[model samples]
Target: MAKPITKIDEPILTEKEKQDQSLKEVLQDLSQNADGIKETMQLLQELHESGILGAINNLVEAKEQVAKIAVGQMLRPPVTNAINNAMAAGGLLTEMNPETTKKLMGGLSKGLQKAEEGLQANKKVSVFDLVKLMRDPDVNRVIKFSIDLLKGLGEGLKD
Candidate 1:
């Protein structure tokens, strides 16, 4: 025996009916967001009035050419060198101890302050004055620190 036709087994819509339903849904969505669409249009109009929108449109149209030129520039020796140097510096910073770096920066600040004060005093330093200054604990400490720093730098360069 053949199965009987029922409403649940029927086709939902014909092709034309489906297209009309889709169009109605799209129109409803547009109507619901009409205010947002208007705001977006106004923003785009302002950008166009300022000439930026036109420039952006031109850029987009020539994107392939622009991208090729940008890639060529980046591949040039100087640009590549800068990129490499930045990476090396970044790697060096990462390897360094943060606390030591902070301490060194703080010491440099203090040293700068002292140097400024000395400059303001306008005092001439004789050989004897230099010897006397070396006797000062802070000066002696900094001299030792500088010597050690130079030694370490030399060792690193030897590699």
Candidate 2:
């Protein structure tokens, strides 16, 4: 029988060997993810071809200037007014009942259609015709709504 083993020897890797092993593992990983790498390269190539990549790079480099310009533009009177008007409109919309708004919009659509028909007819309205219109329930309802709206506007203006 051979002599009983007293020591177990393990191989020790040199620094160069360790580096080579790491490189090999990296190459193996690259091979495994070849499809993903190819797709990424293709997308990069498309962005580069479109000049978007350069634009993005310039934008990144001049971020401060771009930001200042944006802020300046937003501060202009017309832009500020637009933003304020939109905010006010949004606030008003939030305060209004959706059902009432829907009804008003529907009424407006019908009113516009009728107005168009009236325009096409090109008929002159006499004082008597105006008086006759008061007898119309639709006309009376609109008149009442207009009066109420005016009253509310006047009340708001008082503040």
Candidate 3:
């Protein structure tokens, strides 16, 4: 308290001291994460044994060639077409009501089940049987749905 402090002196570390300090910190971290390091080493050993590590190394070494080949493959007509079709299908799916799609899928499953049962029965359908089937609530409902779907499709096509 007799003299007022005018300046502070900070300890300046040499390059060698800085490197040594860094090594000490790294060693401390390694010791703390010994189990994780061991697990990683084991995984690396397994990958090396399986030739995957070598493959990965090669891939890294020839990254430009690999990228070119990948891009070439992706740019192929069939691949591009598939990607485009998938995008279109995704767009169409988004526009469809989930509830309606779910209902349609459920109905389709039930219809398939009935068709399978009919196949097992091996029954022949006559004109009278067709008339009788047309009167069936399930058949009628499906016919109505099909007609409505066609009408909507036609309307969309007009646009």
Candidate 4:
């Protein structure tokens, strides 16, 4: 006689297991949220303080490569006209303006570095510190400034 697979006797998860599972779930949710909010550029300072910006730097470099290459890429999906329009609208202004572009990229890179750092730091930081950092007005202002500066540089490049 063999026990049925549907409801074999299985011990309940212990408290430690439950705690660990809950933490994992919460961390997953935070990671998803962080990815969605990476554009906001709010966590730069903390992330730079930590050392995980190197990983983000790697991702940025990889994206640059993809943008530059079309090796064996399927062309079944033609580039949409709308995307073409957007690219024209955002054509390289840094073409003859390397200095401005360099400064812009430098600042932009630092801001993103912080965000990557934040994601790494989040694993070790408490919920309270996270909330405080998220809600801080200073952080909000800096992100806003970054957004404006980037937008302005992009707009300048259009001519």
Instruction: Say which candidate scores most in TM-score.
Output: 1
- The regions of model 3 sitting more than 4 angstroms off are 1-12
Candidate 1 residue runs with Cα over 4 Å from true position = 1-19
Q: Arrange candidates by TM-score, highest first: which order?
A: 1, 3, 2, 4
- Name every residue pair that clashes in candidate 4: 44-114, 47-117
Clashing pairs in 3: none
Model 4, residue 102: distance off in Å is 0.8
For each candidate in turn, the TM-score is 0.84, 0.78, 0.82, 0.28
What digit string (tens of lDDT, one per residue) describes model 2 on residues 70-124? Answer: 9999999999999999999999999999999999999999999999999999999
Model with the higher lDDT, candidate 1 or 2: 2
Please provide, for model 1 over 1-159, each residue's C-alpha lDDT reduced to its tens digit, 9 standing for 90 to 100.
999866576677999999999999999999999999999999999999999999999999999999999999999999999999999999999999999999999999998999999999998889999989889998899999999999999999994
Against the unseen true structure, what C-alpha lDDT does each candidate score? 0.96, 0.97, 0.96, 0.75
The 10 consecutive residues of candidate 2 with the worst lDDT sum are 150-159
Displacement of the residue 68 alpha carbon in candidate 3, Å: 1.6
Q: Which of candidates 2 and 3 is the stronger one according to TM-score? A: 3
Pairs of residues clashing in candidate 1: none
lDDT of 4 by residue, 95-154 (tens): 548787787688779979988997987767678986787689867767788799799999
Pick the lDDT winner: 2
Error of 3 at 154 (Å): 2.9
Query: So what's the TM-score on candidate 1?
Result: 0.84
lDDT of 1 at 57: 98
Clashing residue pair totals per candidate (backbone < 3 A): 0, 0, 0, 2
